[model samples]
Target: MATKTHRYRRVTPAQLQTISSLAIWIPILFAVFKLKTGDTKFRLFIIFLVFGALVDSFGMIIYYFLSNELFDYHEVFQILYLWYECLFFVWLCFFFLNFQQKIVWRNILLICFSGLFITEFILRIVISSPNDTYSSFIYSFFLVTSSFLSAFALLRIAENTGEILRYSWFWILSGIFIYCFSSFFVDMLSYTAIGRGIWSIRVLANIIQYGFFVVGLLKMNKAQ
Candidate 1:
């Protein structure tokens, strides 16, 4: 991703992004090392962590090697990965569904999230890339997902309201919520001129998200 124009700069934009990507390893490794295999919820999370890493790795390779080619393999990789991510979140939400009104709430939330994922997958099939209109849909998608996630996280924390820091589920859900909300803004601003600035913020938010994920894993181990 480095270019001649960026040669004069001390730290290129691509370099910064690459550096920030290192943060993703934290949660992945933490889960692998600290989280027990018997923990079903974290086991689901690790699946996504591994899957996302594979998708991004493949996308990066395609971009680096075949960017100038006619085929837009990289973009396809991104869209496919994003679509899977939406579904993953829905599953994640289901995994965290442990409220008092479980039967009613579970059915309702599952219906909503399933509908959203189906609609988004259909849109992805219709729209080829991150077009201007498609970007708006993506933004809205994240907004809705994040809102639901945050509400759930808050509800979970409310049970042991004072011990927020000790709740692994809260931290894990908070990280996902923050990432989704931040992604919503990133998609919102992707069409504008200040895209680079927004990209940096997104990168920073991603790094911090994984940090929160690591903390969550640690809390889970400690609570065990």
Candidate 2:
């Protein structure tokens, strides 16, 4: 009797990169075509989306060129990308909060968060390895908290004023909330083998999140 053989197929980082690029760029293209030129919020959102897509593409190019020969360079690129992502989320959270609150408070909150992020970035650079679990955990925690808080604030504003379902911000916040919530644990355990194994799941979560972003952009465009 012949024995049966079983083989496992693993997903590659390059594949994840491709998936992420598609997830980010498809919505960006949709926003470009569907969104109007007015509405400051939508305009800023589109700008950020485009910038993010460009960054992702650039990272992929770097990875293709340097990953095999200069692994450290690839890692550095990834760390820089992560740092950029953190800052972008901080700005995004501030943008949402500012939309609901006073300008003075917005400025204050932005300053505070900017300081915190800078401090954390420095500490991560000084104290943690490039693949440090704690650094990823801290970044994930900040993103999750910011996303949840912004979502709650948006909900409160909607409750007092009008339908939350009708607002673009609501959908955007919902997407952030879902993405951060789903990835929180994975990020916390990012230094572990199990965490590394589940990266594809995180990519899928991001795809769903970006889908919500597209919907929000469409809704916002319709409203304008």
Candidate 3:
């Protein structure tokens, strides 16, 4: 009975939910890539996406091993984590820019983000000191800017169609705003008193951030 209870407690509902959601996101991102891009780019982007996922998986595995002396590669995992993060932004740029439009605002916005994307790539390679600080700022800027743009786009659609997505960009933007601002301070706090390791607060922040996107995606799938 004690062993049974321990087994049940080890695999909690939240972990199960996160796994299920991530599983769903994988297929959804693949489908979106298939429908939106050329065969070559879609395939290449998927390769990078899956590779990034594997890097994250490997980091988790390495961390597990490190904690138990099963193996040790914490430094390697840190480097891979940086690569994983860089690829995520690159993937986002590819995903959006591929869906081109003649619309003036869309073109303008893409151009702006394209410049920022290039900067991020360069910074990823060149900026070495206080790497986390720079990365956090870049990511925060991306999230906050993307959220504003999404909100604006939704508003434009609502104006034209008289129907907006339920919970829609509002929820997504709120999530972005919350995390972007929260993470700025989280980074600052890490430099100060927190000692700079992964904390529960960061975990919770990420959950809320991704949860917002998941809910928005579900609503979109339902609407379609």
Best by TM-score: 1
lDDT of 2 by residue, 1-224 (tens): 99999998866866875888768987887787765443665676676677677766766776666455554444455455555555555566665454445666555655665565555555545554344754675666766766676676666657654777777677887787787778877777778899898877777778888998877776774554
**Candidate 2 structure lDDT:** 0.67
The most accurate candidate by lDDT is 2
| Candidate lDDT values, in order | 0.66, 0.67, 0.48
Worst 10 residues of 2 by lDDT: 69-78
TM-score head-to-head 1 vs 3, winner: 1
Candidate 3 clashes between residue pairs 3 or more apart in a chain or in different chains = none
By lDDT, rank the candidates, best first: 2, 1, 3
State the lDDT of candidate 3 residue by residue for 1-224, as single tens digits: 45544334554434543453355345346346344433443345345445545654654565445463523344444444444444443343333332335355454655665565455555544453335565566555555555454444445545654445474334444454455545545554554456354344544665576566555444443233
- TM-score each candidate: 0.73, 0.72, 0.47
Cα distance off (Å), candidate 2, residue 87: 4.9
Predicted candidate 1 versus true structure: per-residue lDDT over 92-133, tens digit per residue = 665555757765765675566566545555555455433466
Residue 188 deviation, candidate 3, in Å? 4.2
